[model samples]
Target chain A: ENRNNVDSNFKNYLINLKNLLFIYLYQFLISLKIVFSSFIHRLIALCHPEKSIKNQIVLITGSGGYLGRHLALEFAKRNAILVLWDVNEDANRQTVEQLKSQGFFKIYPFKVDLTDQKAIKSTAERIRLTLGHVSVVLMVAAASFKAKSILDTNFEQDIEMHFKISYLSQLWLIQEFLQPMINKNWGHFLTVSSNSALIDMPLISSYASFKLAQTKLIETLREELIFNGIDGVKTTIAYPSILKG
Target chain B: ENRNNVDSNFKNYLINLKNLLFIYLYQFLISLKIVFSSFIHRLIALCHPEKSIKNQIVLITGSGGYLGRHLALEFAKRNAILVLWDVNEDANRQTVEQLKSQGFFKIYPFKVDLTDQKAIKSTAERIRLTLGHVSVVLMVAAASFKAKSILDTNFEQDIEMHFKISYLSQLWLIQEFLQPMINKNWGHFLTVSSNSALIDMPLISSYASFKLAQTKLIETLREELIFNGIDGVKTTIAYPSILKG
Candidate 1:
């Protein structure tokens, strides 16, 4: 009787092992399906072209800068209404003239310092009054790169300016413009981040720190939008590596 | 002759394929060896205990707060000299007294606001003068938590305070103290960061942004140290989940 009991116990253990193997195999197959489907979806998206931005009211910060000006020109070519903001009044006016020369007439230029909260708010209000609600915001502002060791960088001046432009200004602008996008559930938010934000390099601690913070903020905002079921609002972060222009 | 050429080409292709497979197998073996060694090293570290902090001059920011006080007591048990910094004068003095009552006599308490750059510089100088060089710096200070949406949070007051205490102050302190550590090439810098820095949760946008910046700064600092071949200067970032205290 004892021998029979031992045999039955061994048989039961094998049966339990089989059941566990079946469960694991089922889960593995499900995960593989998910991976394959996502790959196919991405392949399809790569083959298809994106939608046109014509007739969209797009706001571009740092419109006087190299990347910003090019982005503005691209949107203008697409027939999107452009609202250009820059601290340099002369450079901003030059951008406006360039756009006009290209035969794009719907351009509004604002020479306002983004570091100032009040300036950002007032300018955002003015833009809303003039151009209706903005459908896209492209944050492209950044402080001049100070290539110095962390020890040599001035905390109050250089580092503070970097944080103000790269991080604080972005936060303020998002707050100023995100309400309309949330209300309508249709908008695009894009920011040009640097590869330094991803790789930790020496001699640019302040810049890297702020850029990383900006990237994290946008990622958080994306999660919040998705959680709220605002699928129409899209976010993109471009990490450009050492652009000459 | 064409069929002969095809056969020869197929044979050569098989030979090339074999060579490629062999190279890949060799690389795969090397990678597996590296991964296994690192895993074993980590497992050993987990099993073994940490080194004692005796005879180390440890500086604790926000020593009046919950985690800071506990860390102080722990180091005190290990017979390390404690330098406590806090903005709250009474609470800092209370911590000193508490340490004294617990029979840890080598405790220095300073009441200075970390947000003030001048205050940080002056106090850091005083600590160097009085207690010699600190071998460990524990950055545990943070702005008081304000539970509000990003829009509701005041840009000038609340958000500014968050940046001041969280990112700027830490930067200032590191600037003031890091030189000596670099010279000696032996020290430890640890900071208590929030899990919010890693995962972007809704609300606490200001706090999360700064915390994320702080985390990135430390990571960058670590890379700098490694690049400079100062391996003795260790850095640790503790991401504690929600704490009741």
Candidate 2:
């Protein structure tokens, strides 16, 4: 009986050791596969030359805002035709003036409310009639941030506003432009989502939720585009950290 | 020159080998840490006994729907008081009847339009006045899924309905009940999010986006509760596979 017990104990020890080794090996291979695939993806992305946007009609929403103004300037420098949309008339005109002063003459400024779907559709139609089809859309507009917890935030006033700006506006714009982009077989969507969408923070529940929704919208759009084999139309989502502006 | 070239090549080879070793070690350590932590968490959860909900007031939205009816049966079996909310009056009454036939008398059915804020508020108030404070909320309500791609989906009708049912209703319900839950220091929030939220799927963009938003809301709520040192209130989000219901 003592001999049999010793043999069984030895067999169990070997089995446990073998199982532990197998588990570690499986984990190591998974890690290796992940690392290798990511490395290859980065390498491929680096190999692709930057696409030129010269003379392309680039529609930028929230052109009155700080990031929008900067993006407009950059696109202008690249010789792309800028169609700037902003609800604030003064700020929109100021952006147009700033671009004109810099000798960027292909700037079209439209004072449009993103929250109003009718205004967005009409303005988009007008742009298409006048300026040709827009090939790129930069969604940079976001509702102003207010530091309030979920309990303190009002649903209709605060949360709805965020939902409109961060989510609904993007939805409407994408709906307006995506069909044309697919027909043309070349377009780009640059969605400016915030870091709040990816992280947990205090007192920004409404902002974070809608921002996350925006990210999901863009993500699903990309997936659908890919599923349809529309490779020419690309979507990029930027999750920028908190900015001073 | 030959000796110098050989020495340089050898040095470069050694450096590359060192970097490769470092990278593998770092990845391995990360994987190990993740595995160890999850194992410990599972062990801790297993050691803790399940909490009893006998005679507790449990509010379940969408009680007229398939999952809701089944949940109603389960909770009734557990001897918990069920407050069922559904826009379909007949279906809600049927759920109550089913429970009653099963010898569960503590069932309350309310015909409330989740899309209407006023109805939800008033109905919630009535529940509070008549049935004491609800200790558990099961958010299982969702808009019916239509397999239409983003372009085919209408913003006002289809998307808005999904947003109202999936995201807004949860927001309103949580707002109504959370403060009371905090006061009681014993509450549980169970959110039934769909698998679409986590996976990339075509033709369900609207449903997926709002479901993701629902998840974010619950996550942020839990974080906020933790930040406030309110550990008694618990939040759990479920990402179930596609259910026929």
Q: Write the per-residue lDDT of candidate 2 for residues A1-245, one digit (tens) a residue.
A: 99999998887677656655654575467556656765887799899987899999999999998899999999999999999999998998989999999999998888888899999999999998988899999999888878877787777777889889998889889999999999878999999997667666657878888888888888889767765657799998877666765
Per-model RMSD to reference: 21.0, 16.4
lDDT of 2 by residue, B41-81 (tens): 77998998977789899999999989999999998888899
* Error in Å for residue A207 of model 2: 1.3
Looking at chain B only, the TM-scores across the models are 0.80, 0.81
In model 2, what are the clashing residue pairs, if there are any? Answer: none
Q: TM-scores across all candidates?
A: 0.79, 0.81
Ten contiguous residues with the weakest lDDT in model 2 chain A: A19-28
Please, what are the lDDT tens digits per residue for candidate 1 over residues B67-131?
88888999999999999999998878888888899999999899889878999989889988978
Model 1, span A62-151: residue lDDT tens: 999889899999999889999999999998898999999989999999988987989999999988887799989999988887777767
lDDT of each: 0.82, 0.85
Docking class of 1: incorrect
